[model samples]
Target: MVEIRGGAATSLDDMVFEFLEYGEESSPESSFSSGDGCYDDDRDEERSFDVEESKAFWDEQMKLLQGTFYRTNSVESKIRQATKEVLKDAAYSSQCGCGRLRVEAGGGCRSCLRREVCNRLMNLGYDCAICKSKWRSSSSIPSGEHTYLEVVHRSNEKRGELRVVIELNFRAEFEMARASEEYNRLIGNLPEIFVGKTERLRGLIKILCSAAKRCMKEKNMHLGPWRKHKYMQAKWLGTCERSAPAPLPVGNAARPAKSKASMLTFDLSEAIPIPGLRRTAVEVGVI
Candidate 1:
């Protein structure tokens, strides 16, 4: 005979069997008298439901947080990449004639004079001092029939850096050539004294400056605002500014001149119609 003790622990199988037996043998009125079991069952179900809801809510929150983090990271990365690419290899070059005149009366051949002027202009950081003065005087500058200046942009890519060169077309040279007598006289004179004698050189200078200004405007239009945003975001994220190397003090004799990316600023309000020339003037100083 199997003996069962009162108030003893029961196995799952035993509990199931006892529950079934009680349900069958006990009267409904008697079962109702002990309401604690029903209440406990309801409480357990409520607890399970609450736990499930809390877990689901936390899971959703985590997903949203992760998504936001990823999106921010993606935008920052893109901006940084673009900024680096735009700044990496930016340069400009011009093929404007030197304001020096060459003629038989000057005892110099046109080809020799042209070469000398070009070489001198290149040495002077590709600036014609004479041209700058002319640009200041002119209301309207001439355009070139052929492109005279080139602006280069090299962008980083997986395959390689993509290079883009913009050639500026101006009408200055063509117009000067059309006025043959004045053009010939202007070229034959020495550049030092020739500045006051000719409008051709001035017109050419104005055109060159205009071309340079346009290039800078285009560059700023494309990248300036985007780069600013990237810089701000980097500053906020604590990824760049704090960790960046300190700038060398101006008075530190031991510090080497560090080359930085050139930032072009264009001031539309200037005596010369060409904007962004102040910085250029500094680089390509007057003759």
Candidate 2:
């Protein structure tokens, strides 16, 4: 009969004979020959190597994916923060003394008076008051003083280039001009002809807004070497339907075409500045 040594059958042939002869021998121990053991060792070593390689590759991939995700999140956060700050500054700059005065004909601050004049001008179809106003200043308003306008840039992986968006905020520079004693004295003399300080402030803001829009249009048109990739571009997508030519009436009778109400879009990427003012200090973020 075969005997188990160290919990293993010493010989496979002996173990089988012993089981057949005794008819009730104990179960044989699981053991391999030296050659078979060496073969298995090689296989296990190879499998272990493969597992390690797979683990390392997957770890690297995970790190890369995580890095990309975090970077995108970081960029978005910065854009949002910058946008909030710019909007706040713009709103603050746009604030005027109009709200402090009661709305009365010939009885309020110049700021209030301007709004009334603007309404009258709008009704009169003189939308280009900034260009035509007698009180419009000729001096170039230096930026970064009463206004903070900037362009923030982020890399577009898909486009393989930088994408730019603008942010603009301006304070009323004409406040002092309106509050000056000379201006007050002049208004007193020609109250009917002179627009208030508020109107003057509005005109300046309009000029700046116009300049900003022009800058954006120019940038989009040029796109600076990345135009081929369509990487940096700006557009003004209004919320009004495109005006189409009206069809001629079949008979002499015809209905008047409904006027399309256009709304301005406040998208920084497609910001439209008021048409004529030139901005001097436009900050751009580093990539």
Candidate 3:
């Protein structure tokens, strides 16, 4: 009888003599080898299934993301149009009190941009305000605060207060320094300036957060906690403070010019005569 180490030896295999087996009949070793082939086949099938399942998941995410972006309601459209107009006008004529450009990029005045958009929306008869959302650090996410413009619409009984968020640099918020191509493609579809209802924004956050997770998985990278869904949702949806948009105080139209006499403009020869001082007129001689 053969002795097996680290495993139980089968009695049937022990009793079956190799000399008794025919050429066509399988031996114990061959049978065990065949079982290994079946196991490999099953593993291959499982791997294929996982790959297809992952592809389907990303595909569905892309579809849902595009759908959410394309769909818009009246309130959102109105606010979007108004926001565009305000930004356009500001680009041509507005400069922040801080002397920064009114663009959304770095070195640009984000507060000025928000104030301008909010005030303009209010002028359009919308209840727009600058909202500051602050949250303490939790187990999942760190403490952080976000400031953005929001419009509150009091619809009829069926629809209560509708909150539409306006993010001037919406795309930048989700941009990752190192991300998969698929994730970049998803973010590419996002608007630089986002104007959408809270519900719509919530849907977008879910889609993007899922995409981010998938992206990290594909890249075999770790996703930062701040990029998670809860953090993103808290930026706009969480409870916070809201203040009505007020026009930035206009700087003085013109500062009065200080009066000063230039020394260069004063004529020394025209000085008033001092007492006991004789005026000397010298005649020029040409040699």
Highest-TM-score candidate: 3
Model 2 residue 276 CA deviation (Å) reads 75
lDDT against the true structure, per candidate, is: 0.26, 0.28, 0.69
| Candidate 3, superposed: residue stretches over 4 Å from native | 1-51, 102-107, 249-287
Q: Tens-digit lDDT track for model 2 on 81-117?
A: 4333332332332223333433322223443333333
* Residue range 1-287, candidate 3, lDDT tens digits: 11111101222122112111222211000111224454586667666776677667777888887667656666666666676667666656445745554443321577876787677778889888788888889999999999887888898778788888888777789999899877888787676667778887899899998888877876668889999999998898887688875657553334456877789877555666567766688897999
2 or 3, greater by TM-score? 3
The TM-scores, one per candidate, come to: 0.17, 0.17, 0.71
lDDT preference between candidates 2 and 3, better one: 3
Clashing pairs in 2: 110-197, 110-198, 111-198, 209-273, 209-274, 210-274, 210-275, 210-276, 211-277, 213-273
What is the Å distance of residue 143 in model 1 from its true position?
61
Q: Name model 1 segments beyond 4 Å from true.
A: 1-39, 72-75, 80-287
